[model samples]
Target chain A: MKNAVAAPLTGVPTPDLASIFGGFFWVGISGFGSALPFAQRMVVERKRWLSDAEFVDAMALSQFLPGPNVVNLAVTLGGRFQGPLGSLAGVVGLVAAPLVIVLVAAGIVARFADSPHVIGALRGMAAVAGGLLLSASVRIARPLWRKREPWPIAIAIAAFGAAAVFRFSLLECLLVLGPLGLLIARIRRHPTSS
Target chain B: MNSPLIELAVVFSQLGLVAIGGVMSALPDIQRQVVEVHSWMTASEFAGAFALTQAAPGPNVMVVALVGWHVAGLAGALVALTSLIAPPAVLAYIVASLWRRFSGTDWVKDIQSSLNAVSVGLIAAGAALITLSAAQSPALDVVIIATTAAFLGSRIQPLWLLGAGALLGAAGLI
Candidate 1:
């Protein structure tokens, strides 16, 4: 198992940096609101860069790590094939076109900030964005509810309180709650086993 | 005295490190610091910028770059984007390399579950905060927010919802 793990994953083509860049660049262009789905389709189905299981694994690790989840996935998958430079290529491709597009849009919006039409549209967009975020939060929290775990739910509530109700900075809340949550998880994972 | 660009770098890099659950989990803090602490933007302006992020493609973390551009310029955008991406990207690269070796270990599982809880909570808080900040007309925004949330997990594309919202606003319904 160790030897198998150490070797490069067989049967998967090792894409060059340009391919990685182009794949993510297309995802950047085509992904409307969220890029994860497009990225999954491209990497797994089209490019076959990684198998479905590996993609899921990368996603799991990306979630637990930091930054944007898709960005992390890009870096992880990129590094898996071609090391640090691969990671760089992946990210630059993913973000470059989108970055330019957003900045240009923002500049236009800012220029028209005083327009009543713009303001109305922005207000509507903001409301929808807020809804989208809440939906995402619910999706993230759903698994915990399904598992029927008490401690994780409690920790989640506590985190919400620390950040929203108490208005503590994110850093402070994480500092206080991160370890406590970890400890509970460790205890819960093996009440008697191990 | 720190330059604005330097301040943007400092602030976003810190955000990058603590962005354990992704940029969504960091939204509230981003809102507070950019709007309240630095006075770089008003609350509504920040909301507008954040809304634009959703309308754009690519990663949501581009919000950082948008804020930087608003505060400074192209240079500010570059600085903020790099700072936010570099730290976390480096951490992710290191962990991804090590992950396969450690995949079988129970430690990864434990961290995954715990971090999920932390991430969910932060994201919820962010949801509430953003909803509140984005509410220009309490009644109309509430309906819009509720309708949007109701469409969650549906086959309907999110762009359609956003477009609906823009149309509603243009029609003076929202």
Candidate 2:
């Protein structure tokens, strides 16, 4: 296992920093509302740098830690493909494009922050955002539903119920579900092994 | 505005460092801190701002800027925006370096798969939370549900949905 881990470190492709940087840049620019799912498809499904399993693993790790999942993915994927330098290129590329656009937009918004038209526009956009987020949730959940894992399904349901109905904090629900998920996984594995 | 600017930078920097599963997952936490703790905005107000940020083109983190701007002004927007995004960017740089060195192990693969499952759950929970918090009227709730259904049922581009929603909102239908 250790040797296999070391193998990628030594033999991983040394992609041109410029090219990788460009990829990250484009991803940042175009990612917008649905960028995350798109990026996952590009890297995991299209590029095959990491298998679906590996892609999910990286996402899990990224989410477990603090910070944006997309940015963490950039580091994990970039680092896996190249090295430390690759990660830097990836991070810079991912953030720079969006940062510039948002800053500019913020400037414009600052001028009209209180305008009725602007407010209306933002309200419309909010609905759209809600839609976009809903779509993202479906995309992420499809695979799990297909797998038909009862525990995961239950965990998802419980989490949703807790937050939506009971109005529990997300952190509280996560604290409850995270361990339950682990315990369930262990039990499932144990049954087969025994 | 100056104090808010400083506050924006400080608060969102903390948020950026802990915003797992994209900006959406952090919504609950941001609400808890900003609305519940700091009283920066009412919960509904935060939701409205979030809606605007989502409607705009760019990362969802742009909401930080909107909230900051609302609280203070342009300076507040800048501070919030920078703090929300910059720390994560820096962290990505560090993690990226270490990740490359550990890419090939089976354990790595296992970990990634498990995390993906968790993210799915987290994101789902996030959606539910937002829906509950933001949707006030049956009409508004219907719009949200319909939009979600449309996104799930078709391969239609997101921009179209956004455009249509904007049109409806402008027309006072939504």
Candidate 3:
């Protein structure tokens, strides 16, 4: 989670609005396919805006809240230094290019949606995407197993069953399990406090 | 009320609030809302949009924008993207300001660890369901999935794998 390169920068000036905007904009442009890995590079290593610890904190904060992890990281870091406008600049800069690109791609796909070749390509890519998702799932789960706790693992299984097997709506799953999970956490933490 | 734009706004905003574990964990529900509940797109069309968004740069959340585009237009895309991101972004900003105060609290740590586990489970379900809808050739897709998983720890860029998938598809080999 921590990077050695994230040692606090001693002489780096506080980034201005333009730099924040431009920095994230560059992240948007170069972040082909995925942005997090590059966002980490830019924020922690290249800019030294956030230390490795701070970047990891930002990531945790991003995941703790909703939305994409990278966008959340940008907004949080921007807000940390520059307040609301910084948040705006960070999000807008990060999203600008990708929004246009996705829109254009969507248009092209619409036009060729029926083409066999287009279908084939999309199908192939979709399968690959599925694989990527699987990898991400396993990666995320590995930590839970390493923690050696039964409750977290049990919660994971229940969640997987509810969504993948029972076909519960996301809202339903969250409503039933979100609080339960939180309560379990609280109980585990305060085993003697309560 | 019946406007696709309005529907897009409502659905995405709701999703934005509950999109724990990032957007990946929300994929199955998103597919459900857009495809099953509203019938905005077929399962394959949803899968197609997911693929396109993955191929494009930026966040995977843009799949919402693409779905909106399919249903309404440019305006729809903007509405979907904004609604989906705006609420969460606002929440993120508020929490970031407060994070320093709560950073080392045991409760915060518990919540974080708990959410991590739940997120993993949801993401796994999403991956399985999406593959079921998107995979055209089951045998080939399984191989693709396994190979991709194996190489995940390697240094190869993901774009290469995506590009390879497209080539295989274009050649009708997958």
Using TM-score as the measure, which candidate wins? 1
Question: Over the stretch B1-174, how does candidate 3's per-residue lDDT look in tens digits?
Answer: 988898899999999888887888888889889888999998877876887877788888888889888888999999999999999999898887777778868888887777777778888998888877876677556755665666577756667777777777777877
Q: How many clashes show up per model? A: 0, 7, 0
Q: Which sections of candidate 3 miss by over 4 Å?
A: A1-10, A32-34, A192-194
The residue ranges of model 2 lying beyond 4 angstroms of the native Cα positions read A1-13, A37-65, A77-86, A165-171, A192-194, B1-10, B13-18, B72-118, B132-139
Which 10 consecutive positions of candidate 3 chain B have the poorest summed lDDT?
B143-152
Please identify which of the two predictions, 1 or 2, would achieve the higher TM-score against the true structure.
1
Ranking by TM-score: 1, 3, 2
Q: Which is superior by TM-score, 2 or 3?
A: 3
Clash tally for model 1: 0
DockQ of each: 0.69, 0.40, 0.61
Cα shift from native, residue A94, model 2 (Å):
1.8
lDDT tens readout by residue for model 1, B1-174: 479998999999999989888888888788888987899988878877888888888788888999999989899899999999999999998887678787757887887777778778988998888778877777557755576557675756667777777778767788
> By TM-score, how accurate is candidate 3?
0.92
iRMSD per prediction, in order: 1.9, 3.5, 2.7
TM-score (all chains, Cα) for each model: 0.94, 0.75, 0.92
> Which candidate ranks first by lDDT, i.e. highest?
1
